[model samples]
Every structure is written in structure tokens, then in C-alpha cells.
Target chain A: MSILKKLPSKARLEQVKKLSSEIFGSTWNPNNIRNGSKILRAPLKGPELVNYYGVNDSMPTFQDFKKWFPELKLVDPREAYRVKMVEDRKKRNKGAPKKKKE
Target chain B: MPFRFPVKFDIPKHAYVNARVLRDQFKRIQYADNEVTRNALRYLARNTELPAKVRLEAQLQLTSMPKYTSYSQIKNRCVATGHARSVISDFKLNRTAFRERARAGLIPGVTKASW
Candidate 1:
């Protein structure tokens, strides 16, 4: 069974959202709200989340998530943010021109 | 009886496709370069299945020195020999050579020790 399937639901989401707001220094938007809810409903395995979310291998743990959302069982946003940043950088590089051939 | 009107969001199909493509390509490139920026490009390339030439071009253009190297070392290497571009080209041709050269500090502004 998928790890995400085993996670807590509704109540957990509320807690996580509250935490996300504090850590991100911004209010949660629809997209992240949906994502955060999904994460709470079924917390994906680290690697699976990385693959699906385009996160890095070095992402944070459930404990870190707890620190952020003390109430919900989740992974740390800091780790998630790190992976997201890596993914973002790759996208930025795609349009750049190749180096001049010697 | 109910009359239904379809609602369309402003987000374009190209934007979604582009983002997906970008992420996949970044994933592929990440294995090669392993930096956040490089990895993201790899993810995009892999997802889009961009032509190999285009992907290679992106890799070449975006490649940079590892963080540990000093600016002076990079400048000196450039003046001493036009090896930076060559090393990157070599990396494209032969993966093993790329690794070796990267280890030997042949690529300007990067060192295996740092990696």
C-alpha cells in the first residue's frame, strides 16, 4: 500500500496549512492548499514524493514536517522547498543558448 | 432544464506543457550536473523528450563551475588554455572522460574535490 494512503485526513490538513503559512511567510493559495491537503490525506513516500513533486533526493523528513505543522504528520517544507528550488533552476536553464563552440 | 456554459481558466495549455517539459528535462540534466538548476532542466528535458541536440545545447550553455573553485583559478585556466569548453564537449562525447577531466580540474572553475 502507498504510504500516503495511510496518513491522517481532514483535521490533519488544517494543522498543516496553519504551519505552512508560518514557515512560507505567506498565505497558502489554492494550488498549494490542494497540494498540502493531498499531502496530508496521503503522505507520499519520500522518494515517491520526490518523483511526483519533482523534489530533490535530500528532502526533509516527517519530523521536520511535524516541526512545521506540529499537528499533522507530514514532511518538512524546507526540504520540499529545496527540491522545488532545484526543479525551478532546471526550468530556468532550458531556454539559455549553448556556449560558443571553439 | 439546465443550461451549462463551459468555464475556461486563463492558464494556457502551453504553460502547463512547458512547465512539465521543463521539469522533466531538468531531472535528466540533474544527474549530469546535480545542481538545483541543472536538475530542474534535466527534469524538463526528460518530460518533453526534447531533441538530444537541443538538450545538449542547453547543458553546454548552462554548465558552470562547482562552487568551491575560486574566480582567479577560473580566469587563470581560461588564459592558460581554452580547456573549459573542450572539457564540456568531451563530457558530451564520452561520459567517462568527462568524469575524469572534471576530477583532474581540467574544467575551469570546477574541481572534483568540491563535488
Candidate 2:
């Protein structure tokens, strides 16, 4: 074997690289710099994250039900309790002070 | 259900919602809503050939978006009771809820382990 084996020329090497990339259908990035293509190729996590909690039944609350059927005159237990407490407090003269008419 | 968040997000809410659970729900919605735009901005910010001024602008815009829009802000909490610790992701329940449901045979294929 020869002491100094001749290496391929720079132009020949470049040609070979271009041909290989073309054959393999790969990007010909000569400078080998960041292109950020990976970001575009990445799968979106939004749909999966949004669906993590499953479907919302969208159950209507007491207020919503009452709004939909105003004629029903639904009495919420908590509201009733609050009204009773306020009434008892007023009877004992411990209720909120009346707003003075300006 | 209580309309707790500052802006009402159209997302599912559990019956036992509290401040923490509401925060998580907010993060989830923010992330899902901005994911595509965020990705596009990230690509623009990272592309080396892009003008430095444009890249910096993209970076600034990305940072200006709410921190809640990042996936890292999301945390998995117990869906049943809003418990933070020892949650089983598959069931979305904390250990306490998981044990109770398992014992009650409410969870399919879950049985008491006996040696």
C-alpha cells in the first residue's frame, strides 16, 4: 500500500453527500445548523391534554334549572336556610343595618 | 360550576372543585388553547437562519404568554376529591378514593389483595 493514500476531493465529497441525500430523500443541510423543523414535526399535545378529564356531562346547577323554568318557583335549600337565619337574626335585632334613604 | 376563575373557561369541572382544582383546570385550558400557536412561535424563535430581531421578537412573545399556557404548569390532582397526593393517574383518583372504590367493587378488575 502507498504511504499516503489520496483522499477524495472536497467538491467530490460534497457531490457524494448531495447524491446520497437525494437517494435517501433527506434534507441537504450543508451547514448542519439548527432549523427548528423538529418543532413543526412534533405531535400536538393539546387534544390529548384537553381530553384527559373525559367528556363533560354539562349538568345544570339549581340556578340554571331555575332560570330555564322560572314558573316552577324552585326553593333552594341553602338559600332557604340563609333566609331563615337572617330572619331569626332580625327578630333578635342582630340583622344588617338598614340603608338610610339619601 | 361556581364560575370561580376570572375568565370563564369552557372546560369540565368536578363537583368537589376548590382553588387548586380550579387552577389546574385553568392551566389545562390555557395550554390546550395556545399549544399550536406556542409551537409555531417556538419554531420561529429557534430557527437559526431567521433574522435575529424576528427570532428575539418571537422569544419575547412566547415569554409574554401566560405561564399557565406551558405544559409544566399542569398538575394531576384527584378527580373525585381534588386530593393532591398519592393520586392514581389511570383512575384519576387519590389513594383514599381509590381504596374506597376498590373495596366497594365500583372499579372493574380491582380486587382486594389477599395473601
Candidate 3:
């Protein structure tokens, strides 16, 4: 019945992942890896989970990490680079929003 | 050196309600119901305000009480009430992601280059 219950899990996860990536600066990785996947998955635990939960001193176990992010995959650095480049290119083409002259 | 006596302090019931009650309640409901409730509880439990309120209540209770409770005591109650268990299944379900992120540098303080 609480407001928190209404948020979509997938959307919430995405938001958390974005925040986690920002705070951890890409240091978050699940413990699984596949040779061809575009994403890197790491078990969420210890400091990472604590950070994600927004708790100052709580430690999250591997099991805790798994519960929150289910779509995690091993992100190859090369693949990540490729993805980043593509995204950057798209952003550049879109260009910054035009500033209004005062 | 003189022998020092250990001073014990207790946390209040309001603190328990604010810091721990909602979570414990949600977990209880989540476990007692089916998948839908479980999923709903997971989302509901994420509310930042709820936990803060609980904590505030606990603080108030602690300030007003005669007999004080320890932090561990509060934690044990939460665990005993099954608040901590709801997420364990979710954690197990998401283990793959955790592993993947670990392999990558997505986790803070973990280097990506090392296998």
C-alpha cells in the first residue's frame, strides 16, 4: 500500500544502476562473465551494496546483490568501449540544446 | 588503572516502529503471500521515508524510555520477524547479475582488469 510499492521493479533497477555507476564509477560488476556479452555483471556485496542501499555502514552479501540486479552480464572492456563510442557519437550528432540569447 | 563499569543504553520502541516496524511488517506480508505480494513488497520496502520515519520513532522511544535496548536487540527482532528474509530469495535470483558486475568494474573499488 506504500508509495514505494507502486514503482516498477525494472525502472527502479535501472535508476539504481545509473546511480551505482555514478557513485562507483563503473567499478560495479556482477561475478558472472560471458565472452560475447555487452554488459559486465558482478556480485553486489560489501561496499557496493551498501552504497546502492544508500546506507553508510551496511554490508551487502553476494546474495543481496543478486536479488537487486538480475540482468547483469559480463561486459568486455572492448565491447564497453565500442558501446560508449556509439553513444557518444549519437549525442554529438544531436548537439547541445540551443541556448537562448538574453 | 581503575576498573571501569560498562554502561548500557537502550533504544526506544518508537525507534523500533520507525526504524524497523514497517520493514518487518512488509517482510511478514511478503512471505505470507504469493509471488505478487512478494514483488509488491520488494518495491514497497524501497521507500526512503519509511525507514527514516522508523528510525526517528526509534530515537524518540529511546529518549523517553527507562529500560534501553541495544542496536543488536533491534536487529535481532527485525531478523526474527522475517524482515531480512524477503530479500534473500531476490538476492539469490539476481546472483548472475552480481557475478557479472563483479567481473566488470561496475562494483566500486573492484578493478576491471583483474580476472
Most TM-score-accurate candidate = 2
Write model 1 residue lDDT over B4-105, tens digit each, in one string: 212211221221224333333233233333344444444434433466677666656445534322112221111122232443432332344557667887
Stronger candidate by DockQ (2 vs 3): 2
Question: How accurate locally is residue B109 in candidate 3, as Cα lDDT from 0 to 100?
Answer: 68
User: Backbone clash tally for model 3?
Assistant: 60
lDDT of 1 by residue, A39-100 (tens): 13332223331132233335654555578786676765787998888778779884446678
Candidate 3 lDDT over B4-114, as tens digits, reads 213321222222233454433333322223333222333333333356565455456444432222212222232122243323332321344445665765657655564
**Can you give the TM-score per candidate against the true fold?**
0.16, 0.63, 0.16
TM for chain B in all models? Answer: 0.21, 0.81, 0.19
Which order, best to worst by TM-score? 2, 3, 1
For candidate 3, the lDDT comes to 0.40
Interface RMSD, candidates in the order listed: 19.1, 2.5, 15.1
Per model, how much of the real contact set is kept? 0.00, 0.63, 0.00
Supply the DockQ value of model 2: 0.41
* lDDT per residue as tens, model 2, A1-102: 977589889999999999999999887889888989889888988877765555465566677779999999999999999999999999999999998887
lDDT of 1 at B16: 20
Worst 10 residues of 2 chain A by lDDT: A50-59
